[model samples]
Target: QKEVEQDPGPLSVPEGAIVSLNCTYSNSAFQYFMWYRQYSRKGPELLMYTYSSGNKEDGRFTAQVDKSSKYISLFIRDSQPSDSATYLCALELSGGGADGLTFGKGTHLIIQP
Candidate 1:
C-alpha cells in the first residue's frame, strides 16, 4: 500500500463554496503532516503542516491532522476559481529528515465561477 493515500479528485465546486480534501496513511512513524498545492506544470508548494493532532487555519485554508487515525485533511473556505489546482498531502517521520517525506496521489480541485 502507498504510504499516503488521497482521492485524486477533480472535485469541482462553485466560487465561494467550501472544499474539502482528505488523505490517509498507514505509517505509524509519521509525525509531521503537510498539505501541498500544485498548479499544472509547476512544483507543489507547501500549504500548511501540523505535528500535533488538531486543526490549523490560515486565512481561507484549514489543515487538520489526526495522528491516532493516521488521517489528514485540508479545507478551503470561500473557494475561488483561482484556487483550482492539485492538492497533495504529505508526511514525514518524527526524525525530521527530508528523505522520509512521502506524498499522496493528489486531488485535483476545480473551482468554477
Candidate 2:
C-alpha cells in the first residue's frame, strides 16, 4: 500500500462554506507534515506545515496532525471561488537525508460562487 493515502476529492462546495481535506499515512517514521495548494496551471505553494503532532492555523487555513492515528487534515474556512485548486499532503520522513517530501495525489476542490 502507498505510504500515504489521500482522497483525490473533486470536492465541490458553495462559497463561504468550510472545506475539509484529509490524508492518512502508514509510516510512523514521518515527523513532518505539510499542505500545499496548487492553482490550475501553476505549481503548488506551501499552505501549512506542522511538526509531529499538533495544530497550526493561518488565516482561513488550519492543519492538524495526529501521530498516533497517522492521520492529518486541512481545514479551509470561508471557502471562496479563489480557493478552487488542488490540495496535496506531504510527509517528511525521519533521517530522510536529502530526499524530498513524499506527496499524496492531489485532491481537487472547487468553490461555487
Candidate 3:
C-alpha cells in the first residue's frame, strides 16, 4: 500500500493563479522524487524529478524537497487552464530500482478560465 499523503482535491483556481501542490511521506529512505501530471484519460507525464533537499525548476514548474520534514512540493507559476489535471507525487529509495517507488493518491486540480 502507498504511504504518501496528498489532499485529493478537485482544487479549483482561476487562470493565471499560482498553484501549490504538496505531499508528505513517512518513509525516511525516500531520496528520489517525481511529480507527475495526468490528464483526463492519459498516462501521467513526469513534470519534475529531484534527488536532494532543495528546489528544482523547469519553466513554470518548481519541485522542492525537505528531507528533515519529509515534505515534497510542486509549485506552478502563472498557472493556466491547460494545467487542469491530476498531480501525483512519487518517491523512491536511493538505489536505482523500482521496488521502493511509492506514490501519493494524487490531487485533482482544475484551472478555471
Candidate 4:
C-alpha cells in the first residue's frame, strides 16, 4: 500500500453543496496532517495543518484527523464556485525538516455557479 493515498475526485456539486475530501495514510509515525488547495497548474497552498487527532475549523472549511485510523478529512460547507480547486492530503515525515512531503494524487472539486 502507498504511504499516503487519496481519490482523485472530480467531484462536481451545486453552488451551495457541502463538500467532503479525504485521505488515508499507512504510516502511524506520521504526526503532521495537512491539506492543500491547488488550482490547475498553480502550486498548492496549505489549507489545514493539525497534529494528532482533532478537528479544526476555519471559515467554511473544517479539517479532521483520526490518528487511530490514520485518516484525515476536509469538509467544506456552503461551497462556492470560487472554492473550486484540487484538494491534496499530505503527511509530514516523522522526524521533520527538509525531508519533503508525501502527497496524495489530489481530488478535483468543481462548484457550479
Candidate 5:
C-alpha cells in the first residue's frame, strides 16, 4: 500500500460552507505532514504544516495529525470560489533520504456560488 492515502474527492460545496479533507498513512516514521493547494496547471502552495501529533491552525485552515492512528486532516472554513482547487496531503518520513515527501493523489474541490 502507498504510504499515504487520500480520497481524490471531486468534492463540491456551496460558498461559505465548511470543508473537510482527510488523509491516512501507514508509516509510523513520518513526522512531518503538510497540506498543499494547487491551482490548475500551477505549482502547489503550502497551506498548512504540522509535526508529529498535534494541531496547527492558520486563518481559515486547520491541520491535525495523529501518530497513533497515522491519520491527518485538513479543515477549511468559510469556503469560497477562490478556494476551488486540488488539495494534496504529503508526508515526510523521519529518516527519509533524499527521496523527499510522498504525496497523495490530490483531491479536487469546488466551491460554488
Candidate 6:
C-alpha cells in the first residue's frame, strides 16, 4: 500500500456547509500530521499540524489524528466559496529531518454559491 492515500475528491459543497477531508497512512513511524490548503497553482499553505493523536482546532478548521488507526481528518466548520481549493495531508516520520514531509495527491473541494 502507499504510505499515504487520500480521495482526490472534487467534492462539491454548498456555501456555509461543513466540509470533511480525510487520509489514511500505512506507516506508523509518521509522527507529524499536517493539513494544507492550496488554490489553483499556488503552493499549499499549512492549515493545521498535530504531533500525535488528538484534535487541534483553528478558526473554522479542525484537525484530528488517530495514530492507532493510522488515519487523519480535517473538518471545516463554515464552508465558503472562497474556501474552494485542494486539501492535502502530510506526514513526517519520527526521525524525519527538516524536509521529510510526504504529501498525498490532494482532494479538490469546491464551495458553491
Model 1: per-residue Cα lDDT over 1-113, one tens digit each: 87789998889999999999999999888888889999999999999988889999999999998888988999999999999999999888864575667899999999999
lDDT of 4 by residue, 1-113 (tens): 88988999789999999999999999888888899999988999998888879999999999999999989999999999999999999888764575688999999999999
In model 5, the runs with Cα more than 4 Å from the true position are 95-99
TM for every model, in the order presented, reads: 0.95, 0.94, 0.94, 0.94, 0.94, 0.95
**TM-score, predicted candidate 5 vs. hidden true structure:** 0.94
Per residue, candidate 5 scores C-alpha lDDT tens digits across 1-113 of 98789999899999999999999998888888999999999999999978868889999998988899999999999999999999999888754455598999989999999
| lDDT for each residue of candidate 6 in 1-113, tens digit (9 for 90 to 100) | 78899999899999999999999999888889999999998999999989979999999999999999999999999898999999999999864466679999899999999
Which pairs in model 1 have colliding backbones?
A: none
Tell me which residue pairs clash in candidate 6: none
Report model 6's TM-score to 2 decimal places: 0.95
Consecutive 10-residue window with the lowest summed lDDT within model 1: 92-101
**Number of clashes recorded per candidate:** 0, 0, 0, 0, 0, 0
Query: By summed lDDT, which 10 consecutive residues of candidate 6 come out lowest?
Result: 92-101
Clashes of 2: 0
Each prediction's Cα lDDT score? 0.91, 0.93, 0.92, 0.91, 0.91, 0.93
In model 2, where do residues sit more than 4 Å from their true spots? 95-97
lDDT score, candidate 4, position 57: 96
1-113 in candidate 2: lDDT tens per residue? 99999999899999999999999999898888999999989989999988868889999999999999999999999999999999999999854455589999989999999
> For residue 109, what is the lDDT in candidate 6?
98
lDDT of 2 at 101: 94
Candidate 1 vs candidate 5: which has greater TM-score? 1
lDDT of 6: 0.93
